[model samples]
Target chain A: MLKVSVISPERTLFDGDATQVVAPAYDGEVGILTGHAPMMALLGRGTLRVTEAGGERRFTVEGGFLQVVDDHVRVVTEKAATS
Target chain B: MAKGRELKGRIKSVEGTRKITRTMEMVATSKLKRAQDRVVAARPYATSLAQVIADLYTPELAERFPLLRQPAATGPSGGRAAVLLLTSNRGLAGAFNSNLIREARSLIERLERSGAAVDVHVVGRKGIGYFRYTGRPLATQRTDIGDRPTAEHASELVQDVMRDFIARRLDAVYVVYAKFNSAISTPPVSEMVLPVTPPERKGPARDYILLPSAEAILSELLPLYVRNAVYRALVETVAGEQGARRTAMKNATDNAGDMLNILRRTYNRARQAQITQEIAEIVGGAEALKG
Candidate 1:
């Protein structure tokens, strides 16, 4: 399982365990799964999708950084909203 | 005695003044609480941002981005520098505005002595008023931010400074504001926000995938760093203002109460003296009539 958190300057949009996550990196879109190696990526203006057993959650984030460490993925953005 | 009546009127006025100060104190206390809450709420974003910046910090990365690049020298010809002075719009906040403005002036003077042209960006009416009355040239003057400044306001202010910095017009950017220490104490602080200082690497270095490139990430991260710094400073200044005001109003209320106490004592003593004199006159008249 992947623990994911999406935080913005205004508020936290999501925090839960997820199966997979796809985010818009500066170069291109990147996908992260459980047990992925630690990585740091820059986020562009695009939708971030987090998939879980329940459903998928989507948020639009701009100008943020994504960090994956020890099965925990953290998305820290300046601006985020439900998309 | 008429003196007793005068003392009673004086006591009434003092009591009225005391009521006003007490109410101001209560209002300032509530404002301080709200400002404190906002400062708490903003902490997470700031800490996380700092963590991200610290993790990415490397001397090489600083060289790659102009925002992180430190100039080799500072002289009159080094380039232009900007100072954003944060103060309060209202005057009742004790020495909050005065302290900040004084710090800004000294900062500007020091920068001038070092040979860098400084542009003063004045925020809040108090700063503007001081700069205006002193005939100090201001790059920008804004009084609309008031007591509560949002991230949007911070971004707006940052945009102006960043434009000049990025365009190579400004070599450095600094912010001067009151740093909140406690409800009773805040000190003026001058901080550099531009030519971002990368946090020193600590502990074991963890390898992470750098998407696009380190330079690209720095491009976005550096601006975000400056924005967060400005936003935090704005929030801190607001908190400091409210704290200073709370303490000031509390002192005023306490002083007013003391004055009222003194006035009440004087009134009571005057009334007693008046009564004693009237009693003595009655006794003298009775003795004279008996004689």
Candidate 2:
């Protein structure tokens, strides 16, 4: 499982374990799983999806960045809302 | 009779005032908690942004990004600076607004002495009124931001200033606000936010995959940093305002209580004296009748 945290300026949107995560990078969409190499990508405006053991959670995010170091994925967005 | 009545009236008024102050103190306490929570909520974004910027920033990137580059020298026009003064919208906050205004004034003076033309951007009614009354020029005045400031509000407050800084129209930008150290120790401070001083890189550099290019990312991140800085100042100022207000209202309530105590004592004394005189007069009249 990948440790994931979705943070906005107003509040922390999500923080838990996820099996897979996909985000809208500035250039394009990127997918991450456990043991993904260390990477940092600027986020654009789109829907971010995080897959857990039970189901998938979606967040509409805009203008921020994503960071993956080891198995920890941190998505810090300027704007995000549950969708 | 008149003396007793007047004392009673004074006591009643003092009690009313005490109730108001007590209520205000409670309101301020609750607002302070919310504002403090907001300050904590904003920390994650700020920390993450700082970490990313620190990781991506290099000394060489300064040449490419206008925000990162420090101007070598002031132009013949003499560098321009903007001071964003954050004050409270309402007045019952003890010396909160005044301290912030004073800090902003001194900062503007210092900037002028250093040969920079300073433009004042006043936030809140108190600061706007102070600047207007003093016949000082203000580039912008906003009273819409109340005790609760959102990220959008913060972005709106500093976006123009950031634009001017990037265009070299303004050499530096400073924010004057009460730094919320604690409920009791919030002091007004002025901090330079522009000319983005990248935090020193810590630990060994990680070979992470960069999105787009570092140059492009740094350019975008710099603006976000400025916005975050402004947002933080706004939130801290609000928290400090509530803190100051809570203290002020509590003191007012306490003073009112003490006044009520004194007034009630004086009223009782006057009533007792009146009753004693009435009894003495009746007794004297009865003695005269018997004679």
Candidate 3:
């Protein structure tokens, strides 16, 4: 499982273990699974989806930044909402 | 007798007002903390982005980029400009909304006198309503900024304005909003928004490799700069609103208390007068009987 933490300006929206994460980057949609390579992306306006074990969740994010390092995906977005 | 009754009604009204003001004060306090938290949390992100832009550019291109370029010699000063005015949707935020309107109106008037066609973009309900009511020209408005303003909400706004500028529709874009300095001090101000230019900063050299060309980076970075600027303004506006509301509510509460005190004094005076009149009548009758 990959660790994921999604934060907005006001509060921490999501923090848990996720199996995979799909985010809309500035260029395109980026899919991250466990043990993915370290990469940085400029987030864009779109839906961010996270799958944790059996349950899945989605959030609408504005623009910000995302980074993947050592099996962890850190998303620092300006705004986000569950979808 | 009527004055006494009026005092009674006034006392009740003032008491009711005190309750509302107290509630508002509490509410504004809570909202201010959240707004402040958002501002603080977003700071690091904004700083990093600025750092990236500073590093990602060659001194030549970054400085000479059209957007980064400074205002031209105003050359007879004949072009039209765009105004982005931000106000709160709801009232009771002190003079936060009105201050913005005042600045916008002044700027618009100045632009008009200078032969600059002004296109106005309003955010929040107060601005839209006030301008429309006064029959001022309005190009666009966002009324969805209620108590909580989100970046996603701001993104759409940023995109719309950028499209206009990029399309050569507006010559310049200025944002009018309240800048929060502290709990007690905030000033409604208009600032240049479009044509992102970081003030001249001299720092150590750091190399950056654009995945593509500098032109490619420029395309992406330009929009990002605009979006972030708008987002920061919105965040600051929200914080200022909360702070203004808190101060206004505190004043309201105090005024209500003063009114209540005045009413109570009148009530006591009226009661004493009635008592004195009764005693006078009784004593006069006793004196007449004695005579």
Query: Best DockQ goes to which candidate?
Result: 2
**Residues B1-291, model 1: lDDT tens digits:** 777788788888877877886788788888889887777777767666777678777776666676765666443355789999998888787888889988999999998888888899988899999999999889998988876777788899999788777777889999998887787778999999987877655566778887866677767777877987888788888889888887787888788788878878888898888789889999999999999
Flag regions of model 1 displaced more than 4 Å: A10-31, A46-60, B73-78
Per-candidate DockQ versus the true complex?
0.58, 0.82, 0.16
Model 3 in CAPRI terms: which quality?
Answer: incorrect
Best-to-worst ranking by lDDT? 2, 1, 3
What is the Å distance of residue B278 in model 3 from its true position?
Answer: 0.9
Best-performing candidate as measured by lDDT: 2
Fnat of each prediction?
0.50, 0.73, 0.10
Q: How well is candidate 2 docked (DockQ)?
A: 0.82
- Across residues B139-165, which tens digit of lDDT does each residue of candidate 2 receive? 999988887888899899888988888
Q: After superposition, how far is residue B45 of candidate 2 from its true place, in Å?
A: 0.4
Worst 10-residue lDDT window, candidate 1 chain B = B69-78
TM-score of chain B of 1: 0.94
Give all TM-scores, in the order shown: 0.91, 0.96, 0.78
Question: Tens digits of per-residue lDDT for model 2 on A1-83?
Answer: 99999999888899999999999999889999999998988999999999999999999999988999989999999999999
lDDT of 3 by residue, B39-63 (tens): 7776655664565566556667755
The pairs that clash in candidate 1 are B75-B115, B76-B115
Give the backbone clash total of model 3.
0
